[model samples]
Target: MSHSTAFASQADLAEKKTSFTQLSANAWAYTAEGDPNSGVIVGDDSVMVIDATATPVMAAALVRRIREVTDLPIRHVVLTHYHAVRVLGAAGFVPEGAVNVIASRATRDLIVERGAEDMASEIGRFPRLFQAQESIPGLTWPTLVFEKELTLHLGSLEVRLLHLGAGHTSGDSIAWIPSQGIVFSGDLVEFNAGVYTGDAHLAAWPDTLDRLAALQPQQLVPGRGPALRTPADSLSAIAYTRDWVQTLLQCARDGVAAGHTLQQVYADTRRVMDPVFGQVFIYEHCIPFDVSRAYDEARGIANPRIWTDVRDREMWAAIQS
Candidate 1:
């Protein structure tokens, strides 16, 4: 098979430019051109990092960016979810200081359950994102786990971590800086990028998004795109993510209602969503995974199936063949 015909993101090895922009006086965003983003919060004494990069090597770049502005130790690291691409970089933060890795209890459970399988799957799928796979020592386990919400203070800065509901994953959480009116929405909101719903809770995602929007953030750092600097852009990102999820789920629902096979459902979904979201980042790469999850949800699959590397290839072949 040609490289293009292979599994999603398999051959995408080109480098992307990284942007580290300050969102507020204390909050910053390290965004690549649609790759996973990390949010930085500089408090009065120390620093907190949200969403570590894919590997320790990749995360070193984020640390360098953080050092460009502040020399305070990175005392806290927060995992918004259990995806390897987002959390495996916790190792990188250790060198800076005694990092207190934090996550929702559900996320920690997921990491313990499927973190290995996910690491292999993600590395195989997105080579460019994981710059140095060997640098990843092992699964990232959070030292600090919370149930619904946790509040912390980095000196005078107040950071509220809340698990609104399930969207990207069962443990999806967002870092809210209430005083700054800034929110670091993990994968719950993607701006101008295709949503990756492979491990998503499609049915509950919208309501989770509703709760996220209710916070009325003035600035928002999305998981995969540039940081939104204004309240208008922040709200628009939420709307965009909501529409994408709704559209994909609706297509899956329609296919299931008409008694279509998975392949047929994928085809129908691509036919409609491609024209609209085809130009977005990772559009082609995400559709197969997104449709599969959506179809399973439409057919009453409550929990997302574990996506191993073998399963990834099998599913890709089933849909692409």
Candidate 2:
């Protein structure tokens, strides 16, 4: 099938080349051409990982990369959100002596509400990312959950995880290292890649981006791009994501105001978004879902609806029709 006509990501088969880039003394990023990125923080005593890959088998690759830098035990695995692609790989770190999986209370709530459905939906949507699908035990549950913010001491280095606001998802959280002026933004910021808003807060996303920018991070690890080393590059990533969100929402609003159907709205959104984001990785895969969610939000859907495998096919058909 042509990439444009195929179901989400099913046509994508090529493996991405991964890079392990150090952003600070304690901060590192594992990015893969435009695939989901993971963050590694090597503390004085222990280590912390943000956003596990899609499956336990996939996460082993990340573990190997971490071992190249430090033998420190991975004590903590932090979930930036409850997406299956991000959290289902927690079990992979268990063999490395990772004891605790951390996430915000809102994240845990999301897992309770729709984690299973999301897992099934995502596995069906992006087959390649799942790698060894049989290796995933089940939904990843956080052993430690907190509200608003939580502070952890990996020996002497302090890592702060804060749920600043809802953007990517209502449960979105970020890891901030105050001493090093570094931040790990999970799927909240995308640079030179498609911003997936399939389960996002379209209207609140820009404001959440503002709160993330307020941290004034000297270095940043975005969800889907290369690590930003300079403050200027960090801010530019934020602006890049903000512009995408705002532009997408505006297109949805304009289409809805003109009484366009979902298909019509999708076409209208593509006309505007494609010119700029068309060449980005996963652009073809993400735009359909992004347009669907934006259209729903513009028509007064406050909360994102659950997406199951059945729903995924139905939506794909509706847009394609």
RMSD of each: 1.6, 1.4
Lowest lDDT block of 10, candidate 1: 1-10
Clashes of each: 0, 0
Q: What tens-digit string does per-residue lDDT give for candidate 1 at 110-150?
A: 98889899998998898888888899899988999999999
Candidate 2: global Cα-lDDT? 0.92
lDDT for each residue of candidate 2 in 230-250, tens digit (9 for 90 to 100): 999999999999999999999
With candidate 2 superimposed using the best TM-score fit, by how many Å does residue 213's alpha carbon deviate from the native?
0.4
Query: How many clashes would you count in candidate 1?
Result: 0
Q: Estimate each model's TM-score.
A: 0.98, 0.98
- lDDT for model 1: 0.92
